[model samples]
Target: MTFTEQLRQENDDVFQKIFTHPFVDGIGRGDVPKDSIIHYVKADFEYLNAFMKIYALSMVKAKSRDDIRFFFDQIGFVLNDEVHPHHNFCDYVGVEYEALQSSSLPPTADHYIKHMMHHAQTGTIAEIYAALLPCPWTYLEIGQELLKTYKPTKSHPFYEWITFYADEEVERITLELRHRLDQEAQDVSQEQKQLIKEAFRKSCELEWKFWEMAYICETWPSEQEASRI
Candidate 1:
């Protein structure tokens, strides 16, 4: 099988675990309190907008052809679908663009965005891919699994939204990004491969943290507080 197919298989396996994960299942099914999920979504939206700004700036600063290409590919997707008419995250969260533009998010959210921007600006194109790949990869994996597991019925409020993100479009994007990464990997130095692995590992951790944060935000007490209780 091709490298892309292998990556897809790996991603699929990981996502199966994620979809059945108690935490993911809880949030996806709206078992979490409404207020908490709203808070998480709102905060995430604010962070997303800030992330977009930093991403744009980083792309501007990208010196190498590969770096510029990676930045533009991501920017195009965000602008064309994720942020605009095709799939407005703000709209999904019931927040107006103006509100998202004006609002401040949690420090953790800021840190995550900053980390991604820093990698994009200072790291190699491969490094940036290592950093940025987790979010969509994780989402797509969970989405595909959810598609299989969660039968869409009237009871599931966000079924359509969930399926949309995890469906064909997300799968296509995942394939595209993985292909780019594998191609870019060939050009990177051996030392950079280690760095990319470290960065990718960190990126994955951060992604896990992000989801945990969402779960915490969706629950009344923080995860720590919940644990203590």
Candidate 2:
């Protein structure tokens, strides 16, 4: 079997555990109230705009032609055209692309972007995959689970949004990245391989943190409201 397949098989239990975690359950429940989720989704879009900018910059800084091309293809074709269109994720999330072009973002978001860029610039291609792969992979996995469990109806505001990202394109991309990571893994030194694993773990943790931040933002009540609820 390919390294990608081997890793997937080996990590099946780990992935299953993550899928069943309470935090993911909370998101899948869609119990947070539509307005709150919308607000958080908007914030997430703003966050994504910042993310894309850094990704673009990293593309420019990429040492290899393949890396540069891959970054551009991901951003231009997948993110911009495929994912963003379903919800106008930027507009719905209240982030004008032009404004994102002009302004700064939260420190945490900036730090995440910087970390990914650093990996791209200084690390091996496998290291870069380790850093970049988790975001989509997590989304794809969660999306599939959610779809199986949570059938969307008209009552759900972002059902389309959820469905779009969870669909075939993202799945294909995730598999492609996994293949690339596995192929590149053989070429990396032992220390670098360890670093790649560390980076993947850190990236997954960061992803959890990102969702946690959204949940926190959504759950926070105003002082007056807090007293009532």
Candidate 3:
């Protein structure tokens, strides 16, 4: 089976859950509350900041200029075209962009960001790719499926967000990166292959939790903090 197919086979449960998650399904139906989506976008903005860092580090790890350029291009798009536009949506949904900027990262977002950064900084190029694949690839897949399920309308709050992931250029980039990672994996030892798969699975798990974190609007526990006064 193709590596991408294997990834789907191994993570089928998460694949199903994420696509069918109430938050995701609601977005497709245009029924998710504006406040709920606003909550999600705020956390997502913080997540994308770290996502760009991983892409930058991966660029340093890449040996080929083409690969390096790919990573660099991803960073540019995520920061400039992909993620930043959410701020406009946030404003429309009652989530202030400046407020999200000042806010500290919540518990789940902090842990997930740290995990991705750790792998991105320390992992081999292929490993870094494995760790980073779930977010973009899954989002792209979700976007494609949702576009089929519900035709885009300007009235739907997430139309632009949904449309971004489904863009042909973005889909092309995602597939190209996936093929590159799978090709890189072909020469690695079985142990290393397992490690890469574990990274893939763990990253998928984090993606799953991130959605839950948004659904619940998870925050750092106030009572858990030590009292200074």
- Residue-level lDDT for 156 in candidate 1: 68
Misplaced by over 4 Å in model 1 are 1-23, 54-73, 83-101, 218-229
Ranking by TM-score: 3, 1, 2
Candidate closer to the true structure by TM-score (higher is better), 1 or 2: 1
Q: Residues 1-229, candidate 1, lDDT per residue (tens digit)?
A: 7433544454454445556655567646646544445555666666666556655766665667876676666667666566432133344456555553444555566667878777877887667766677677887876666666676654565565567677787777676767777877877687987777666666565666665666566333365486897
Task: Please write out the lDDT profile of model 2 over residues 16-89, one tens digit for every residue.
Answer: 66577555565566544433344445455565655566457666556688867777777765446544532533
Candidate 3 is scored at a TM of 0.90
lDDT of 3: 0.80
Q: Would you estimate the TM-scores of all the predictions?
A: 0.72, 0.72, 0.90
- Candidate 2 collision pairs: 42-93
Local distance difference test, each candidate: 0.62, 0.64, 0.80
Which ranges of candidate 3 are over 4 A from the true structure? 223-229
Question: What's the lDDT for residue 145 in model 2?
Answer: 84
